[model samples]
Target: MQRPNYPSGKDLLSADAVSRFDLDDIMERAERHLREEEMEKAGHALPEPPAPRRRPKVIATLFDQRSTRTRLGFQAAAARLGHQSIDAYDTDRNRIGQTTGESIEDHIHTVELYSDLLVVRSHMEDLPYRVGRLSYLPVINAGNGADEHPSQALVDIFAIRQMRGPIETLGIALSSDTRARFAISFVKMLKLSPPKRFTLCCLPDAPLNPAMREAMTVLANLGTAIGIVHDIRQTLDHDVLSIQMQDMSKFAHAALGNEAVDKEKESEPFTLTARKILDARSDTLILNPLPRFSELDTSCDSLPNAGYFRQVQLSVPMRMAILERMLLGIPWTGQADSFPPSSGG
Candidate 1:
């Protein structure tokens, strides 16, 4: 396939990398893919698959953390696109993390030669950036230590747009850890299409993550009516509420095996329940990136407000769109012209 020329780089390391135009393009592609699937499922005739690539593209996943959805979603998306994925990092079998392991430079050099694109998830905040600098292949940051999950943000925006309506007309609330990677990416990506009202429901005592603060500042400057509230109830009037656990550091540490998992209950003020939704008489759509903790009550599962499961369903086509665009050499032009260096937060 012939490649398209775009000034933006091939790597999607941060939500900052996607421009409004890039986001629209991606969403259009995802919607098209989704429509075709729905049509096929309805027993409608569809065009035949294109001829296979002589050298099918390889997507290399280097996840140094545990996952369920993101991992399988990308692998499945690749298969649908006639591509394959390789687990590039294996702590037990690979020399990368051994006592006398090869340097990251050496490891990436070898991995880049074998793969056409790299999707990275790491506990280290800068690992993806480091890999992006080292590899010629397109790099997608699956998730990074309290940094950002840009793709998840894309999935989320796509979900909201699909389920609710245009984002610009919506009142969106995020009830999550201020440092959560997905939250950071979500807010950052929102700068592309600022919502009418953006409210944050977080712990009253905790300071906002610097990365999140900066991203929100961008949205505020874009004319989004930004508000910060301590209770989830305060956000119930919004059209959508994207939620997650409050303290991500505890989970991050547990994922790194540095400590036992924290099983502490979510704070009452932050938790969202069906009763609360009913009592408030609000019809806010609820969204959670799963492996959900107590913050999202199961009581809300059957409620009309629940949209996380549908969010997961929408992720497949989004992933397919991302892979298809990058594989076609279309660069993301969503980044600001005067982009500053990431502090690795």
Candidate 2:
């Protein structure tokens, strides 16, 4: 076929048309609309329930990484929306490690034939984006590498917004090995005028992983005040903290380059002590992505301002929105057509 005469190169907006259209930006706007709809659903409008859309679909939950709450949240969200969820085991279950290298694109294509949406948690960061581009169905990034956990980030942001209202100015204290991974998700959440500050509290010897360093640079350019501190004492200045502490005893020899007196002595307190810091801020929000060891004191849970439990609760509604978007292709915009005519309500 002969190509028609095209507009002159000078008339083109830019060399990269894809740059003009960002998938993440679109998804972020959609998320905001859904959140508002959820709020309306929970408000005084609750006496008349909104008619649920009938979109029968199947969601594939592919996990190559360890997950507890994430798996359950996605499953529950799918069920609530009357969708089927298929749990796919690791690639090792198939012959990927054998004769033919099962490429991500191939694996996604095969799964897309069976399911309407793909929710994947992989050990490699690039895998999700690769599959999203190749797959016909919507691809949700559950957790990727030590990189982004978009769902977790969304839920966390929802929790913060619920507790503190809009996050035009906010503070977050993130600690430990997974900081960089969570950082990617958190930075996107900072689109609400960007966080006033983000403090990293790590052990003096523990350096942030490479991915985290890159995330910090990116966030800094976006007007977020990023700081790395070796002590939690510095974090007391911040109002909210989402903490993750790690035991470095295993890598102590290599990373620390120190032959400690005793292994027993190495078992120092990894948990945050709140008794002293509690007085620092009148209304402090403490969050630990659970399964915490000594990183967070249990007694602090009883405090009046403790919002960690609230964070976990917010995950349900957030996940519901995500499943609706990815599996059922529900529009996130709160436009009139997004929901059926509401006489039933």
Residue 45, model 1: Cα distance from true site in angstroms: 1.8
As a whole number from 0 to 100, the lDDT of residue 295 in candidate 2 is 64
Could you give me the TM-score of model 2 versus the true structure?
A: 0.70
Which residue window of length 10 is worst by lDDT in model 1? Answer: 336-345
Encode model 2's per-residue lDDT on 45-110: one tens digit a residue.
543454775856887887776677888878877776667789865644654445666655466667
Q: Identify the leading candidate in terms of lDDT.
A: 1
In candidate 2, stretches whose alpha carbon ends up further than 4 angstroms from where it belongs are 1-55, 90-107, 178-180, 218-222, 247-270, 279-282, 327-345
Residue 65, candidate 2: Cα error in Å is: 2.3
Model 1 scores a TM of 0.93
lDDT of 1 by residue, 141-256 (tens): 99988888999999999999999999999999999998999999999999888999999998889999998899889889999999999999999999999999988778753454
Per-prediction TM-score, please?
0.93, 0.70
Clashes of each: 2, 2
| Alpha-carbon lDDT, every model | 0.89, 0.59
What are the clashing pairs of model 1?
Answer: 18-334, 19-334
